[model samples]
Target: MASPGERAGEPSDRGRPVNDVQLSKFLSYICRHGAEKKGLTVQEGGYINVDDILELREARKNGYSVSDVQRVVANYPKQRFSLRSKPNDDGKLQICANQGHSLEVKGLDLVPILRPEEAPVVVHGTYRRAWEQIKKQGLSKMSRNHVHFAAGLPGEDGVISGMRSSCQILIYIDMKKALEGGLLFYRSANNVILCSGDENGFISTKYFEKVYDITKGVKLDY
Candidate 1:
């Protein structure tokens, strides 16, 4: 069932004419960061229609096939549109909006309940904050990858080491409890925070810091 010009990864024949959804996916794959305000722009259906063609032609010249182009273009248009709708103060894409853009609390916009700057702090109290931070900062936010690098982990992607797997902690501590229990801290290795528990499942670094009074006993010679 193979046609002359059609192969597994090849584009449909020259005039095959892909359907809208397929075309949309293909177009998105072709020029992911569409226009970028200077690159591609949308004409309809949240898909790029014009300038992407130019980029596609260049890709073609560079030996990129229709299928290859289709993939990259397909995945990122909605993100671009969301970024375009509300750019950060610097006019750059707010790559973090997918993480609720720090604009809501309890899945509700908190504009009425809190000020702009205060919203982040309030949102930080929620369980989803860590993921929000991850999306906003990528591998740079908590210095996860960097810490892992410093700790001597290997490979291109950062490794995870703390508390078994994903380093996610679930705890609800009020101010009084925090003062008595102490805050947790971690050391890095290949962007990983290695952790261990004596007998309990997982212990908070803050608790260790407080119980040992480590922060107080240390003296800086310099």
Candidate 2:
């Protein structure tokens, strides 16, 4: 079992061609959940020193190199990782996860969605079994730092992240209501809308503008 601070690798865009998945998952594991645990100094915006990261025991054991890391970061369809940024004081490059971080990383430079007009169709995708509980208890961030919502439906132009193609249900959020209720919203670098929800760590049912069973093509009561 993964210990308190450790976590299994999380999902990303489906059916998107990727190379070096084994190495990619390792990199993702480090950036999103294991940087602090691995003793890498995570800086503002969750950026980690690549020199430090590539020097990890596991990375060294596997003979991973900077170009290998850069290849994985560049080929990931969702653009989950950012590499080749301006060097630090010592002239070493860095890397960071665009979102889906459990670390209390400040200044990820996420764009705030203050007005509903900013994301006209912010919606969370899930399954019916979860929705049964979600309707009553509201959408929770679960393992992540914030609840993820796609800016628009899958296959919709410009909608690249935030959901899996296999989602069986879709819950539309009233952004105006969410913001009015004091739930802050931010857009990740990959265009995923994120909210920590309310103080209780749930986005209440009151903010659900509509719910639909995508498999049935019918609206469901919430």
Candidate 3:
């Protein structure tokens, strides 16, 4: 039988012949949601042992090696994951997804955006098709963990916050209203805004003060 490290295959500068997209999906699974399912232990800060992650059956099946994880952490366009030195062990390292987790990761130390000056004008992007429902119900986390927002509008220079290309509508959040309403917000390492939503998984429509149809020149008042 091949050793676990040998079975993981050799590392590559380009993250190997494995498709980058597939590898990313795999990482998102184990790092964010499937660690328990895969039998890997996640620490208080959501950090997982890199070696244990590499040993996962799913990871092995996908041909993921430690090097692939390192490369993805270093080069992924959005920087969706981060690595850190394990506590009390300077030489040891661990990794975790920066955000976008549906799992209830206890002790995840996300930085709070408390001061008004530190909180940017956050925006959420969606399609026009959902406008009526959103107007009635407000923005919800839907399936994933917290509600995700971008720091600002998508720029001409191709800086994508969290907006998808298919997003046709943009909702500007009134942070003042949210803060006053007692809703807390945190900024992920990748700069995505996350908030523990209400019981219905929504941030409530009241905070969505302005809506714009990017494809159209009109602003929606709701």
Candidate 4:
């Protein structure tokens, strides 16, 4: 499962073939964020019968099938979806997004992050255009369920966990201060950090220790 703060889907690279990528995006849209919008039934733990998803007009038009879904699950670099046998019904298999759910899914057995050592500082990557507002108002979950963070700092081993190529700014969070400030954090299966916002759905800028404008190659003190 994705960390509680993570959202499903990644920016699509233009040069890649569109069919499978589109199918993966469509799956993430419905499975992680918009099942009800499509009138698809989501069961407890956010599982949806594979056949039910395949019944969608778009799915049929695209020639999507169980094998296609399996391929997506197996090949998606993030491992965003997981497939399992229905509880007490070994004959049936169900699929669900590992995390990043906007829908009110019940009984999702998300694991908790109990050890502080496991996550030191959580990083958030965004475009520079949003930096001013974020500097003043802080990071908000927006329409999604949680404020997502990368498990580690950027440029570490040439891998920035939660970062997208579109991002030009990186926000480094003070996790210790955040926890001391009474914020709850969870780590998703893929090591993305997840946190539900306070009553107002925002994590104030006070928790951010540093902001780097990667495009400009400098850190903004403010």
Best by TM-score: 2
Q: What's the lDDT for residue 87 in model 1?
A: 27
lDDT of 2 by residue, 1-222 (tens): 222122113222332222366776787888889988988888888888887886899776666667666666666666678875645475567898888888888889699998989889999999977988998899999777899999999888888778988999999998888889899999999898899987767999999999999899999997
lDDT of 4 by residue, 1-222 (tens): 332123224322322223567787889998888789889889888898787888888877666767667767777766678787767865566788866888888866566665567677678999978888888888998877788887765556423346665688989888777878888888766666788878888998888889888889999976
TM for every model, in the order presented, reads: 0.21, 0.87, 0.85, 0.84
Residues 1-222 of candidate 1 have per-residue lDDT tens digits of: 332123324444343433434344333343333334345543222333332453455443434434433332334322212222222335322211111111111221111211222111110111233434433332221311111111212221332221122223222212233233432223321122221222232333332111111224431110
The CA lDDT at 170 in model 3 is 89
Best by lDDT: 2
lDDT of 3 by residue, 59-152 (tens): 6676676777776667676767888878897657699888888777877767898865676578888988899888888888877889888877
In candidate 4, stretches whose alpha carbon ends up further than 4 angstroms from where it belongs are: 1-18, 153-161
Model 3: worst 10 consecutive residues (lDDT sum): 1-10
* Ranking of predictions according to lDDT: 2, 3, 4, 1
For candidate 1, give the lDDT of residue 199.
Answer: 25
Q: What's the lDDT for candidate 2?
A: 0.81
lDDT for model 4, on a 0 to 1 scale?
A: 0.75
Worst-scoring 10-residue span by lDDT in model 2? 3-12
Please list the residue runs of candidate 3 whose C-alpha ends up more than 4 Å from where it truly belongs after superposition: 1-16, 88-90, 156-160
